[model samples]
Target: MLKKLLIACLLLSLIIAGGLVWSYQQVKSSLDLPVQTPENVLITVKSGTSFRGLLNHLAEEKIIRPSTWTRWIPRLEPELVRLKTGTYQITPVMTLRDVLALIASGREHQFAITLIEGDRFIDWQTQLTQAPYLKHASKTMSEAEIAKAIGASGIEKLEGYLLPETYHYTAGTSDIELMRRAYQAMMSLLDEAWQTRDQNIPLKSPYEALIMASIIEKETAVDDERGVVSSVFMNRLNKGMRLQTDPTVIYGLGESYDGNIRKRDLRTPTPYNTYTIFGLPPTPIAMPSKASVLAAVKPAESSYYYFVADGKGGHKFSKTLTEHNRAVRDYLRTLSK
Candidate 1:
């Protein structure tokens, strides 16, 4: 009877070990199998989603099988499971383990919005309001209110404060957060450029450099002309000459401008009318690029003080009034042709 009892115990122990090995193989095979979807799937895990709920979602999407293993794996291996809230991209080739590891890593899909150089603050607001992915917090707020909310209350205007570049964010990101990031980026770049600014420049502060940069952004579309344009403006500033830039006058005209700048527009007395202001505008007219900002701080060494559109997507720079007038006449002759 004792031998029979020992034989039964040994047989039972072997059976238990064989069952454990079979269970391990089953779990490993399930984790290694690819999902059913032919294309990549985008899954959104909402806030406060439970682990069981996530498993159910995967089963519903047919990414994983609805079986005992699916239910038991997460419970048994809790250390390998981490659930997060955001949009995730699940590929067809992903295994159960790959999907779990991706969620655990919390690297979600990012949506992008670009703020173009020379765009006005209103344009930025429009893009933010139109982006379907962003969580709009200031859709109806005034510019002043928005500025205050973004910790920019000290800024007199919001036109040139934000940097122009592509910004990527996940779902539920607020407009205020995006704007704050842009503002901070511009501030950091401006501080760095100001620290290394050329000596004896007429700019009183970084704000002045920003004002000049905005003008440079509007003056020319040619990348190489930025430095020369900055030099022309700086030379004019040193001589107390009016900037005579059409964009500033148009900006001052605002809604009144009917796609034309008459002689009267140049004589306008608005704060933004550089043709009459005798210095940089009260604030930047638009967002400027990094190149324009650098040019503002370090203008090219030149004697040029005048420029006219050459009617070829570029400018004809001049060092004397006679040369400028001749270039203007040539441009006019081309227009007549």
Candidate 2:
């Protein structure tokens, strides 16, 4: 009777070991998949959720069998807890064993935030707010909020800090995090550009250089004209002449612009109006690109003091008002007809 009982115990132990091996292979191999084949699926692991809850979610998603997990979890890992919060991509035929391994590894994803060169403030705000993964921005995301995100304080506008580039972010990234990355990148770029700035520049600080860069950005879409425009502005600055840039007037007029810069708009007084102000605006009027920043710090060698639209979205430059007005007459008159 004792021998028979010992043999029964040995047989039971062998069966359990065999089951473990089978279960391990079932999880590790794609051949055990009951469905078509391996498939891809996006999974989000929520914070503070229980391991059982996650298992239940996976079961509901049909990635694993409910009965199989319910039977195996207690036996395999009773002390298991939910994973850290993140976005994960899972595969079909992935069993509980493989899923647990993934959770432990915490492999997340990265996505992009595209900042176009010509995007307006509201346009950037819309892109940030519309991103579903990022936390909802507060109803009032003030310039201060934007400033602080990029390691600045008390800045009146978000321009210059909001770099024009494609940024990579994870699904777990917050709106502030996205803003922070952009600002840091812009700050770094500014430092690099400012280090090589011309000594005779009229700008007092790096901030002022950034201000000039934004003007350069708004003045021309053509890359080659950026340096020329910078030279024109610098010349005007040297002579105590008004910038008379139409974009500055548009920015100064705020939301009142009707798609046109009328004569009265130029004559109007506003803090942002370079036409009315003797120097750079109180703050940057728009976010500038790296190229624009570089161009501002290192203007082209020229005596150009005036520029006008050349009817092809570029500028006709001049060293004197007479020449500028003539170019304007030629270009504007040609376009109007």
- Top-lDDT structure, candidate number: 1
Error of 1 at 67 (Å): 4.3
Prediction-by-prediction clash tally: 0, 0
lDDT of 1 by residue, 1-337 (tens): 9999999999999999999888877877777778888898889988888877888899999888866666667755675577878888889889888888788789987889999999889888889999867899998888888889888886657888899999999888999999999998998999999999998789999999999999999998788999999999999999999898988887788889899888887876999888777888888999999999999999999999999999999999999999999999999998899
Instruction: Give me the candidate number with maximum TM-score.
Output: 1
Which sections of candidate 1 miss by over 4 Å?
1-20, 37-40, 62-68, 256-258, 332-337
- Write down the worst ten-residue block by lDDT for model 1: 71-80
lDDT of 2 by residue, 1-337 (tens): 9999999999999999999888865534432334322688777888886777887787678776655435455445544343768877676666555666667677676667788875666678888888756675543767677666557787766766778888777685677777777788888999988888899888889899988998999889889999889998898899899888888788777778889988888777888877777888887878899989999999998999988888877788888889988997999788888
Where model 2 places Cα greater than 4 Å from the true spot, the runs are 1-24, 27-41, 48-52, 62-82, 91-101, 120-122, 145-150, 333-337
Q: Which residue pairs collide in model 2, if any?
A: none
RMSD of candidates 1 onward, in order:
2.9, 4.1
